[model samples]
Target: MNLALLFEDDFVSADRAVLTGRRLAHLNSVLKVSEGDLVPVGLVNGDIGTGLVVGLSDTEVVLQVELSEPPPSPLPLTLVLAMPRPKMFRRVLQTCASLGVKDIWLINAYKVEKSFWQTPWLSEENLRENKVLGLEQARDTLMPRVHIRKLFKPFVEDELPALLHNTRALVAHPGTDTPCPTHINEPATLCIGPEGGFTAYEVDKLVEAGCEAVHLGRRILRVETAVPVLVSRLFDACN
Candidate 1:
């Protein structure tokens, strides 16, 4: 927990805030902080700053905070992803957040298992929790938005065109002729597939929707590994 992520409810007054739940435990155990100590803090979708610990107890910790600096600039990228396995989804989601990706679309692909969407991690509460973990890890505060589209064809035909507007759009497919471009450092929409990757028909739909199919050499990277690798390759982080 590089930053203690603050929400509106965490504030008692304009300058005062309280921490409880997992954060409180992190304070007592991991951070081992006490009164008069300075702790890193940031408000969700707000600014990054510091907090002076004014009070502490087993239940909660109180701090007086000042927020001035803006959070890291969001990456100008939109991630269109095929729903990964349940075990990999959380990691992929966090990687996207840590890398400053603010827009995400989790769409269905032919290779994606229906069971993947049934994972509780897709729940609003759980999604926020994982995103918070990512934000805190990256010392960032701006929350990323996740859009779920279970129907692949409808999403590609009816929605993806607008989403790709004014952006460099690419889909990562193994064995594609074009290697994924590096350091574009501009607004881009990238589509990545499931463990086995998108089938030929699925890739065709995405390509038809203004995406250029690209590859990461001959290596087939897992969704979790590919997300960060591709994002870093495509953009300068938080610059």
Candidate 2:
């Protein structure tokens, strides 16, 4: 972990915080930090700063923190993605958070297996844990929000139009004529499909909801690879 992400529960006082569990292990093993050492730290959905290790032991570490710097600016992109395989989903979430994507929508596509949603990674506790890992990797504190929509048609017809408001909307399809636009300065809502890509009918629904169908050349990238690639392509800031 690049930064120790502190939650409200970690704080013992306004300036003091405690670390345990994975973070404590990281401190003892990975960082080999001790009392009097300073480490990068940040409060969740708060500022970035440093913490001085005032107390340390095998059980816990006490930090006196000072937060002054703001976290990285969030991307103005809303990601509407088809649920990926369970094995890849955690990595995708971490990548999205690291890339500063604050808004994420995981929707079902025709090719998406129903079993994908049943993964324990989607649980509230596990979701937060994965997001924390991502935030720490990026040295960012702002948490990304993940929205799950299991039914495809209802989400497209009912919710997607409102989400597309004031934002450029594009759906990444494999064989579409239009290339995915690059270095866009404006806010955008991007839709990506499952392993085999979205079915024709599913693509039509998304297009009808105001997304322009676009492609990333002839290569078919997996959802995990495509997310970072698309985000970097669309936003010059990511480059």
What are the per-model C-alpha RMSD values against the true structure?
Answer: 0.8, 0.8
List the candidates' TM-scores in order.
0.98, 0.99
Determine the C-alpha RMSD for candidate 2 after optimal superposition of all C-alphas.
Answer: 0.8
lDDT of 2 by residue, 99-185 (tens): 999999999988999899999999999999999999999999999999999999999999999999999999999998999999998
Best by lDDT: 2
lDDT of 1 by residue, 45-163 (tens): 99999999999998999999999899889998999999999988898888888889999999998888888889999999999999999999999999999999999999999999999
Candidate 2 lDDT for residue 192: 94
When summed lDDT is taken over every stretch of 10 residues in candidate 2, the lowest stretch is 230-239
The C-alpha stretches of model 2 lying farther than 4 A from their native spots are: 237-239
lDDT of candidates 1 onward, in order: 0.93, 0.95
- State how far residue 44 of model 1 sits from its true place (Å): 0.6
- The residue pairs found clashing in candidate 2 are none
Per-candidate clashes come to 0, 0
